[model samples]
Target: MDSPTNSQKTVSDDEEIDYSIKPELYDSDLDDKDEQWMAKKRDGRTSDAVLSCPACFTTVCYECQRHEQYVTQYRAVFVVNCEVDKDRVFQPNAIPSKVGKRTRDSEKQETGSADNERLNPVFCATCSTEIGVVDIEEIYHFFNVIPSEP
Candidate 1:
């Protein structure tokens, strides 16, 4: 998807894309698996394919299935180039965040409280379909995603 604003360029379906780096790569912080994927991209042996919401064809992100889960638990990137509406939330992960070493008691003490930590749900702006989750506690971005496939 092309940015509605002209400063950003849209990629054609047939085009061969090579981004210096995808934002998600940094977001994940690069595990060994992620590093391998990066090496492949650098060598021009592989590239990411566009992953979009099937319901509305809204481009959600560009990713390689291999490099996925490098940063987040699932192989989805929330801070993707695609457009979404934050207001139209539907579902949330029933599971709680299992951040390391912090017990329920510790979480309450460390950050003042665990209540402040939040995971944002991503929805399709056009169809309101839930696509992914964002960790809003640290900042205004997603820590994980469920990349939609057509």
Candidate 2:
């Protein structure tokens, strides 16, 4: 009888060989079909809401996604449901007459024009879509009042 070489492994009738090393060799079509099925499964939903700039009418959500420095002046107010507390919310402080005057004067002094006003987000005047949140201090401030947990 000839002795087996190191490259040749002896297999008995009861031995099981693992063919999983070349998984792609077995199911190329099945893998492609699975990818197609996943792509189809992922295409059924639309966004319930969208954010746009009040002045420019451009989609500002992408800009808001990036972290930016913002000054939270008392004039610019926003209403937001607290994610953690649930019950309490922050509403924009009413623009005080004195504060408004100061802001206007400051703008006039710095820019030589009184057009540097912070646009307050209200209901989209054109689309009538409710402004659900305002981005301030790089945080999303939700307007929906959250119910308190018992």
Best by TM-score: 1
Residue range 1-150, candidate 2, lDDT tens digits: 888886787777546655556755577689789757644643542222333534435332311121234222111122221112223233456644554444666755874432232223434334444443333332443232111111
Candidate 1 segments whose C-alpha is farther than 4 A from its true place? 1-49, 63-116, 137-150
* lDDT score for candidate 1 against the true structure: 0.50
Query: For candidate 1, which ten residues in a row score worst on lDDT?
Result: 136-145
Candidate 1 structure, TM-score to reference: 0.35
Give the clash count for each candidate.
2, 1
Candidate 1 per-residue lDDT, tens place, 108-132, comes to: 6775533455555665665666655
In model 2, where do residues sit more than 4 Å from their true spots? 1-63, 66-93, 99-114, 118-127, 132-150
TM-score of 2: 0.20
Indicate the residue-level lDDT of 120 in model 2.
Answer: 32
Measured on C-alpha atoms, candidate 2 has an lDDT of 0.37
